[model samples]
Target: MTISAEEAARRPLVSDEQIEDRVADLIGRAIKRKWWILFLDENGVQLPMIVPVDGAPLVPDEAATEHSIEGLRVIMDEIGAAEVILVWERPTGSTVTLPDRVWASSMARAARDRGIRVRAQLISHRTGVRWFAPDDYEGHLEAS
Candidate 1:
């Protein structure tokens, strides 16, 4: 089933602040583990590029204007075989809304085209709180 951003905003769940906290905690964990963290602007250009998983902002605090597939594809082309592209997806409002299956599939295909393995994850505010596989937009994340 398709869930628009508007629909997700109205759902009963954790407050936006709590979601941010969760996301931050997740990002911190990834960084502490020394995994690679990537930050992308709305246009899909890497702001700081992929850095050592240090405590850093994987996603900016400001709202994203958009996450275009074209931009993602471009970034994917530059990825190396030994690298993993962690696509940080910011949740819309208080909910996480990923692109539809077709868009996601295309995004995944773009990464594979360059032999780069990509992982779609949610990250924003006070870090990466959750990790998701390429095709794992299962549903809205509920509050813990």
Candidate 2:
């Protein structure tokens, strides 16, 4: 259900300390899950090598095109990765927005093309927490 602005405002505010603890906990969980973290470069055309969850920060590229499946596909191919896990970073307390359905499709296509696997996760930078992918988000949210 869509919540009105007033209703959203009525929710309790989260404190910075809470956010930090949450983020740390989420990262710990991700590590336990054995999921590697990667950061998209400024061009959004490239990605750093995957690292352990505790290795380093996984910052999302702000300069990346909103629709960058093709670029991601190329990276996936070049790396010959067995699996691709997308990490989306959003400001604290903000709702998570899933990637374009096309993005997910493209990831799947890349996996098929390379005989690999693909997955994704959302990270709230503000709360330093990770959230489950949106349950109701359907195919590419953005128009191609």
**What's each prediction's TM-score?**
0.33, 0.40
RMSD of each: 15.9, 15.2
Off-target runs (Cα >4 Å) in candidate 2 are 1-67, 97-116, 134-136, 139-144
lDDT (10s digit) by residue, model 2, range 60-143: 232332224445556656765434445444343444434433333444444456554444444444544554343423344334
Q: How many clashing pairs does model 2 include?
A: 5
Model 2 scores a TM of: 0.40
lDDT of candidate model 2 versus the reference: 0.40
lDDT of 2 at 81: 44
Q: Candidate 2 at residue 92, lDDT?
A: 39
Tens-digit lDDT track for model 1 on 1-58? Answer: 3334444335422243433343353344332222334543333333334444333233
